[model samples]
Target: MKELLKRYKYAPADQLPSYCIPITVNGKTCGRLRPITPDTLHSEEEIRLLTEWRSASGEWFTTQFPVTEHGTRQWLEQQVLQADDRILFFVDDEDWNPIAQVGFLHYDEVKKQCEFDNLLRGRKGRFGNIMIYALLALGEWSIRVLDLQTGYLNVLADNARAIAIYKKLGFQEETRTPLVKQVEGDVTRWVVAEDDDTGGEAQRYLVTMKVRTEGFYETLKQIL
Candidate 1:
């Protein structure tokens, strides 16, 4: 898995696979999961689109800040493309138009585990629940090809829609931690504050969920 991850991370974007996987629904390809590359950010418009998605979806995230194209491109280069343990993919429709983004991060080679990160439907109502299949595709590849033992994700406990989707994908809730918003300058980040009962300014809880790799593919098949 480490070697494969290295290839995905270090290999030339053009040389790597065109897509991480193709998402299928009802025996038809609905979208493709393409890794974000330099080519993906070649155009200023592309960067702006990504920035818009992040800004629009900020409410569901722990951190909220004014998103800018400069910041977005910097993050893509330093935090994503340059990182060895993380890989981000843009979910493109059948026509190859990017509609969403999903990826895995914080890979633990020793434990064969990783966290599902940055799932956002940038363009809504275009694919019609295709994000679920896109997630399943990534999860399957992570387990079958990358040989991961478990997959995990952290979601805002108040995000009922996202929580339901994760549950449908076979992730079981493991823990929930109370969070308090900390504001500094233009950024506001939700930080772990205290126990669930010590409610003062902490209004949100972060929920961690896990899914075993053993029956991951089977679960995908069942869903499909």
Candidate 2:
């Protein structure tokens, strides 16, 4: 699998086949793993909510807060407009407003593999299993639509809550890299995903896990 740091020219985001799959829990629609467009309405509040969530959740993500209105627009453009790789989108349900996002950061169609990053769920995510249901929606899409065999998830070793969630999803830890500290200003803790110290720094170290999409679709079909 290719690390996210390595970049290559990818087809335009519009040219790629979209896998914006929605998920339901119990009888209600919880959220979705939808595709993002230039017109997607994610305001500064949503941006700040995600930023605060990541900062509080530790190093699974590295985006910081105080993203001003202008800065938030730039960040959105960077993810969908300026990005040469990775396709990003919102996860919306009841209110048609997004509560989270999913990204295919490193895509290798030939290898049937991709790494997911920028999975952020705000305080209004799910009831209890916030992250699980979101991931299931995306993971199911990865298997069915993308035809991917292996999905890579990067996380921090010390984030037990997140690690347990991944394990339940059948992701197995594969690699761990000793991350160098990179902190700007006063951070209560530092954890990292990539070399971008902008998020914070690695709490302990950076670790990646791999999961196959073999049984995901079959399982989701029965439940959702």
Over 1-224, each residue of candidate 1 has an lDDT whose tens digit, in order, gives 55566566555666755545788888888778887777756778778879999999998999999999999999998888878888988888888788889998998888889999999998753568988989988987887777789999999998999999998898999998888878999999999886653465567889999999755766787898
For the record, the alpha-carbon RMSD of candidate 2 to the native fold, in angstroms, is 6.9
Q: Top model by lDDT, which number?
A: 1
TM-score of 1: 0.91
Local error of candidate 2 at residue 42 (angstroms): 7.6
Q: lDDT for model 1, on a 0 to 1 scale? A: 0.84
lDDT per residue, candidate 2, 59-93, as tens digits? 45443344355655676667554565567656675
- TM-score of candidate 2 against the unseen true structure: 0.69
lDDT (C-alpha) at residue 223 in model 2: 49
Stretches of candidate 1 exceeding 4 Å from the true structure: 9-17, 195-201
Error of 2 at 156 (Å): 1.2
Q: For candidate 2, which ten residues in a row score worst on lDDT?
A: 1-10
CA lDDT of 125 in candidate 2? 51
User: Against the hidden true structure, what lDDT does model 2 obtain?
Assistant: 0.62
Q: Each candidate's TM vs. the true structure? A: 0.91, 0.69
